[model samples]
Target: MNRFVRWLSASALALLATIVLLPQPAAAAPIPCGHDCLGISRDAICWEKEWCAVPIEIKGTLPKEGYALPYRTADGTASAPADYTEVREGVLWLKPGGSLQLEVFVEGDSVRERGETFLIEYLDREGRVVATATVVIRDGV
Candidate 1:
């Protein structure tokens, strides 16, 4: 009787160990950016004249509450308010699942110089940079 009881206990322990050691399926990954993601359509824009405008198309899955597109210009050859005008505002908003065309205006003039470069960057809600674009002012007549 004692021997039978010991065998039953050992069998139960072995069964429990096997179940615990079995592999399990992994959990699904978390959705990025609150179920929506954002990106830019292009990486570069060239200006042919003074007061030239470059359109940066906003692409990707827009959030339900809408998103505010933020950007700032960094001078390469184009200096703000000297070679280019200050951006009217920094934040542009878009509706859910919607696309938008935002313009980057470059102040142009008849200055035969090397191509002036400037940078435009888009920021996420947390002020993190999501994408970047370069604006080049062609040097010509």
Candidate 2:
């Protein structure tokens, strides 16, 4: 009886040690974007007075018919007609699982200056802002 009890205790301790030393499952990270999320292909871009295209992507599932989202540009540190040609307002029609690219004209100059920034805002049907993408204009020089 004494030997049996000792064996059982040793087995229990071994099982407890195995359970305590086992690797635990990792916690999941929170997703930054959700359904109908709008994102840009490149978060930051360099401009040298040439034509620049910003690739806009739509995340998550879309309706079978299609989706239309209104977009417009706003000045950040960069202003229109001086830093970049302004895109006042435009409509982007995206089919299911489809994406679109927007062409922008960035002004280039020989003057030395720090990087500038601008914003492209996506709007809903009611003209409410949904998502925004920041465009960084780095000096090409």
Candidate 3:
């Protein structure tokens, strides 16, 4: 009886360990832009410019909880694990001409920063797309 109890306990521990080591969903590597993609999505988001920083207000629903989002710039670079503020009353709501002012301060003394948000629009019903736009910021230009 004692031996059976120990074996059951050990089995439970092993199963728990295996579950903890399991992998989470991984976003597939971005595919190259086929024609001309002006927006960011599951594939990739690209931009271009010189010396800039801008705060974007992401309006709309996100993927499941804890979805790893990627932020890619125009110069073959990306920055993310972005500042994702929670949704509350007046939190993340944007009027037609309303805006949120985020900052992007690049390092280096004389390095020019040219960054742009190629596509900044919310996906619509049926998860297709409705309106799309780009936000460009040229910091210290």
Alpha-carbon local distance difference test for all models: 0.61, 0.70, 0.35
Which wins on TM-score, candidate 1 or candidate 3? 1
Per-prediction TM-score: 0.57, 0.62, 0.25
lDDT of 3 at 101: 31
Error of 3 at 17 (Å): 71
Q: What is the per-residue lDDT of model 1 for residues 73-139, given as tens digits with 9 covering 90 to 100?
A: 6776688875666663386666664445556666667767777777666666676666656677776
Q: Mind giving the per-residue lDDT tens digits that candidate 3 earns over 1-141?
A: 999999999999999999999997563322112122222323222233322323443334332331222232222232321211111111122233443332233332235555533333333324333333333433333
Residue 29: error of model 2 in Å? 16
lDDT by residue (tens digit), candidate 2, 1-141: 999999999999999999999999543221123365444334448585977766665556555666666778899999997998888778766666555666678898888899999877777677777666677898887
Best by TM-score: 2
Collision pairs in model 1: 50-108, 51-108
Q: For model 3, where is the 10-residue window of minimal lDDT? A: 81-90
Model 2 C-alpha RMSD vs. true structure (Å) is: 12.1
Give the lDDT ranking, best first: 2, 1, 3
Task: Give the clashing pairs for model 2.
Answer: none
Better model by lDDT: candidate 1 vs candidate 3: 1
